[model samples]
Target: MGEIIYLRDQHFAEFHDKCFLLLSASNHIELSRQLTKTLHHMLVTKNTPVALYHYLPTGQLRLIYYFSFGSNIEYEDEISSIRSFEALSHSQLTYYALNGEHETWGYVAHPPSSYIGSTHWISSLVDIAMHQLGLLSAKCIDRQQAKLKTSRRLLSKDIHLFTNIEEILDRHRQRWRDIFHACGICLASQGALHRFGHCPSDHQLLQQLSWLSNDAEQTDVIEFEGSHQGSLAVKLSLAGTHHGWLLLFRDQPFTNKHVDSAIHRALSCWLTYEARMARVLADDLALTIAALEISHTNRQFITTAQQLASLKPAIHSAPRAVTSAEQNNK
Candidate 1:
């Protein structure tokens, strides 16, 4: 027998298809299930426990399927007097049945025997398995890319309606509230940047023509300390920095695919909205400064023109008085 390793249910889902493929080929479902249960039992072992997994062609750990007998168990409280295959580490094993290694049928637990040989069977199994998994992974990645593309387009359209940051925040407040209700946590988050000339995050930014800081983003988190609660934290990045983040948690976290997708889409929309708002605000500020400069220039022109008008009369009177003095002397 071999050792089974402990892993969470979500972790199991990650490699579920691959493991099932191996088991179905060998008709080893019953054996695999028993092995998983046994692994759960050995999670709290005080002594060294065997780690069982198949080495993939990609040089990555795969099917790290199970662990061994232990003094206690956390997964199952009431242990039945069930005897499954015992797990043993390589050092403890007397022999390894290399013939047991195959694509459909993984290497099974065997009494230790000493033999060092690399056969075509092990190599072929790894190659075929790697190809199949690689294709599956590629397909998944493509689907995700499509979803993100669609999400970005929709969000960009929605953001155009918001004129300013205050409007964006107000409109999204309800959605944020709903997110909190669903996720079981609340995060009061904001983004801040000083005006171009006033920005002081870095000395270099001050010298630059654009007043934007090289890097100045803040992210804060406060976890929920409630019973049976779980939280999901996701940060949305734009232009190489975190522009926004979403905080969600719940007493009983909903694991539905639809809910997760909706949350993700909404967060993306919020980030796009924020970015657009910032641009609009910057444009408005520029307009305001130009207006102020024009007003100041007009005031100075009015004062200078009035002074010139007053000096004209004084010059005209001085010429007449000089003429009258010369006539009296003659």
Candidate 2:
């Protein structure tokens, strides 16, 4: 069993307790569905723009979800990669293949080495995940008559069946929350976070988060000061469309010790959840539209058939009337 670590961030600690309470009674997919619904409400209430990205085994990163308030950002570009889900990095090209640890949910890279969070915690998650995988793999091998290679291939092909979109979204959100808890301390001093544009150049920091971009990325930042008179500002760029950053500020000059780490943790989770929900909603919309078209077509066909059947008696009566008129003339 994995040991649960305490998050020292006050706000995050409260949120985590709430999350544990929410998750205790439910399974994984149910928890995620609830989380997405809750996150959507939060997005509307908070009026924040958030996006989620999932790392693919492929070198590219895909945008799984996003939620924006009054921001001008569009989710898709019907043509090319303009707004169409963009790929940020290749898996093999990165250090994840070498020193990085993999987990049932996903890989976690800690700071000093990586900025996401604790590498040890990430490694532990990976180990447990791998153990589960091993058990699953054994079951497959026992049930099948094929050799190990064939069994492996069969299991790989069916992995998606066992792990669907909802599970991925849930796990992704949770891992992101942990990362935020660990990394949130950095951005607590920042002010309200909002959507912004990104820089075109490849940034080293962005590269680690799999956000490296040649073209300018969208920027999201937290302005250090409120709508008051005068205040100094510091910016923290977050991972989002076109190099988005989060800005933090203070009314009076304050040190980093005053930062609220809990909010940062919450934001991380919110961003990931929002992104997943966005993609799922987009896909759902497409499916619903298609289903509606099919239903309309079927309805029209049924109406036409009914009308044709109703006209049959009238045609038969007309012929008989003509025959009777001919007999009378004779």
> Local distance difference test, per candidate?
0.33, 0.30
Q: Lowest summed-lDDT stretch of 10 residues in model 1?
A: 75-84
The Cα RMSD of model 1 versus the native structure comes to 16.9
TM per prediction = 0.29, 0.23
Residues 157-219, model 2: lDDT tens digits: 443343332332332333322322212211111121221122122242233223312325422
State the TM-score for model 1: 0.29
Q: Worst lDDT window (10 residues) for model 2?
A: 91-100
Candidate 1: C-alpha lDDT: 0.33
